[model samples]
Target: MEDSHSSTVYKCHLLNGEHVYLKIPYSNVKFHRELEAYELLKGRVSIPELLDYWSGDEECPGAFLLSELKGQSLTREVSPTVAYHVGVIHASMHAIQPPSSKRLNGIQNEFSNWSAFIEKQFYSFAEDVKEVLEEGLFNQSVEKFKKMNQQLPSPDGPSFVHMDFRPANIIIDGNKVSGIIDFESVRFGSTEVDFTKLYRDFLSADTTLYQAYKEGYNSIRPLIDLDVVLSFYRFIDAFNSIGWCKRRGIEKNTVFLEENTVRLKEFLR
Candidate 1:
């Protein structure tokens, strides 16, 4: 299948004519993390059934996995009502409290506490484009981001966050949600962080879409100081996305980056 992101994904038919989704991770760590999260949440959520996972090293350089699912992505066609159900699904996932033993230090701490991991694994990406990054527009954007991140509120409780929740990650069939794919970014974080992607990226800021989502979400659980959490995530997301685009040599996404930055600044004010 055609993929928009770095990861390559394909649809293959099995001997029984069953459809399976295959994802080949670009990095070893990401591939392992995807498998870890899949194993952890397999029976708990409406994820595709995993058939197998294989890890390959220098000779192969990555990992690949097979999973079965039965619908197109919700990003293909979304409406206010669809946004509402998406909210419901996200809320449900957050309700599943992970065992204390399973929780790792969050992404925020990963950069600090996991510095060794960062050095061994992630630093290459940054080092590769350090020259481009230093002379780029992103240098100023990063400085502004530090200021915006300071306005975020502390998390109230730890919850299972999809970390990449968005219409593109959801699969739909007719009027119903068939499945959710891509658990690679799964983490234990403020549940509100997950909702930020939906509210800011997927829903188009349409009040009707926002209300529908809120209605479905409130039907399940009460959100605590939700506006504060949304604001926090909005700022952080814009900040992180800008850095990500910079590292990838992406300039067109600057428009989206600037738009969210403005929205976050306004909300904070």
Candidate 2:
């Protein structure tokens, strides 16, 4: 079991020849979010079943166990067939609207206006963005962000979204996606945010896998104005990554951020 940035994962062997993944989260929010999200999406998707969790006392802290999913991560290579299967799974996840009757103690992303939301999200890392950009450049980026937000489509109604849906989180078994792990960033929000990684890699590559993914996702729920949404989110995601790099001291590897900033500047024109 590999260690995630926010948690330590351990493969534990239990009695009756069953193995389970024990995850110890550094933050209570991550632990509870995963627990609640898994509870909400147990049978609905191809995910490792949450077996049990312990909100440990003062001595223990927090821990959870999930039935070990059997598959290899598609980090290196994801065939077109597997990518299509992943798209199908992701579509299913997006299809599951959060039930009004139930409330999980999870992250809520309810925003009244998309413009305000974008501004707030960006300004949350205002200092960090300023750190990497000059005063004029920062103001220019903010102006572009505001203009883009104004043209965004109306709310598409809240839907379940894995904020970090990428190749590393997808598990493959032969030609199909067997498991989708790492639900800590899961939330109910704009469907556009979920397409960030896919658009960045698959869309840019224009590979058969991306075509299969587009076909499969459209087969379930059509991605109306996907290119437009991806365009806006590409900038938003860049701002986020730049902030992350600043926070984590990885400013040297923000080549994508530079490219995204150039695109955002062009979008303003």
Candidate 3:
């Protein structure tokens, strides 16, 4: 299973001084995901082109080589116009229908129904997070979701979604998006789930960016209504992050663990 950690990306300069990236992925599953995602999204989106890959054995991490997308990672330092471009790129990703084989490869994203998928995320990850979180917090969160379940909208389409669509995944060259990176979490699922990280990390802090993002997305495609299920999805995102840290290593993720704990508590309230 691919965890929360990304592959190590190494920049290599050719004799001519041009560069490519040598990526040593965290898991074989991630290697498969990057390879498949790069292959499927070629020319469809601004992604690094994959050059070669290795499935790797238990003793060694899976790895890959790919072309580099030269630009800065689109972090908090972004403008509304750039956010709009990111929105367009994201909407395009959601418009795709990944093959069943690729869908099944993402073990966590195999569910066809978004509601069931969210339920399973809570049920399975809840056990892993119980020890890591404060006492009774898990139960409280479960009850909260149970109540919200009654109000959740119908299942969104099983479209391809960038599972980790945050600013860090977006690359900006001037006002436009040069490329997007890290497709290891690509999956076919509800598009609303993709909004959580981007909203929490960037758009939530700036209304102009959020509005422009929506406008850009709507210009390319009609979202059923992100507002309706955003809270539900966002809560799931926070809850899952807590467990992800616990499973990956609490010691190494103190800041992330603390932030997610705060988010989880806020959501419960």
Candidate 4:
């Protein structure tokens, strides 16, 4: 598969011609994070089954196996009902309480608190973008980043958030959401953090779709005040993406680089 996150995926077939996916992640840490996500969400969420695990060799770093999810990638626009169900599914994910730390005072878990995690993430990315960004825009980005706290509402809880939740990771069959794939970026954070990608990719395009999604989310849990905090989260997302493109490759990530560049400018203004 042409992976967006630099992970390699292969569609392997069984003797019965049933398909399974072998995923060799770019790093061991990413592999472990995906493993943790699958183990945690196995029975609760509509995710693929973890079948096998591979230790690193000189040739490959780390890998895992996943059962096939029966659905097409939701790349294009979907119906409001499908969007609603997706909203519900995402809510179920956020409802999960994840571990912030394994042992007492062993390591300061960034996921323990939303505000602190976000602030730490923001500054760390700030150092990366400083190298790639021009002086004026960089200054503007920082100024805008600093002001985000005043606008954002206090997060309800440090919930498990699929940080990369978007249309491409979603699977659909007819009008129903069959499953979601790609769990490498799962983390404990403000539930509000999860909505940024979905909004930018799909929900923001139509009012009715966004409203229906809100209704579905509310059915499972009370919807946060998205209107109050989306811009704040979106700006942070853009800044962090710019940093990613810098580290990965500017030429290869042109679309993402450009999109996030425009996002930063728009938010800064």
**Distance from true location, Cα of 210 in model 2, Å:** 1.7
lDDT score, candidate 1: 0.61
Q: List the residue pairs that clash in candidate 2.
A: none
Question: How well is each residue in 120-219 modelled by candidate 3, as lDDT tens digits?
Answer: 7788888888888767998888888788877987666677777898877788998899888888777777787788888898888989988888888888
Residue-level lDDT tens digits of model 2 in 1-269: 54254467888887888888888866777777888888788888889987788996665558888887778776436667777787788898888886878877865655345456657778887778788767886787788777888888876647788888876677788887888888887777778778887677554675777788888888788766676777788877876666666775655546656775665566545
Cα error, residue 184 of model 1, in Å, equals 1.8
For candidate 1, lDDT tens digit of each residue in 1-269? Answer: 65336467887788997777778765665666677667666776788777777777676535555666566777634576776776677677777665657654322223222224323332343443344333444445445544645565655345667777877788877666777877666665566567677766656557787777777777766655666656555655655554465665657556655665565446445
Whole-model lDDT values for every prediction:
0.61, 0.74, 0.80, 0.82
lDDT, residue 20, candidate 1: 74
Better of 3 and 4 by TM-score: 4
Give TM per candidate: 0.74, 0.84, 0.90, 0.91
Q: All predictions: root-mean-square deviation over Cα?
A: 5.2, 3.4, 2.9, 2.6
Q: Using TM-score as the measure, name the better of candidate 1 and candidate 2.
A: 2
lDDT tens digits, residue span 15-85, model 4: 99899999988776677778778877888989988899887787787898888888887744678898789
For lDDT, candidate 3 versus 4, the one ahead is 4
Model 4 lowest lDDT segment of ten = 101-110
Task: Report residue 23 deviation for candidate 4 (angstroms).
Answer: 0.8
Score candidate 4 by lDDT.
0.82
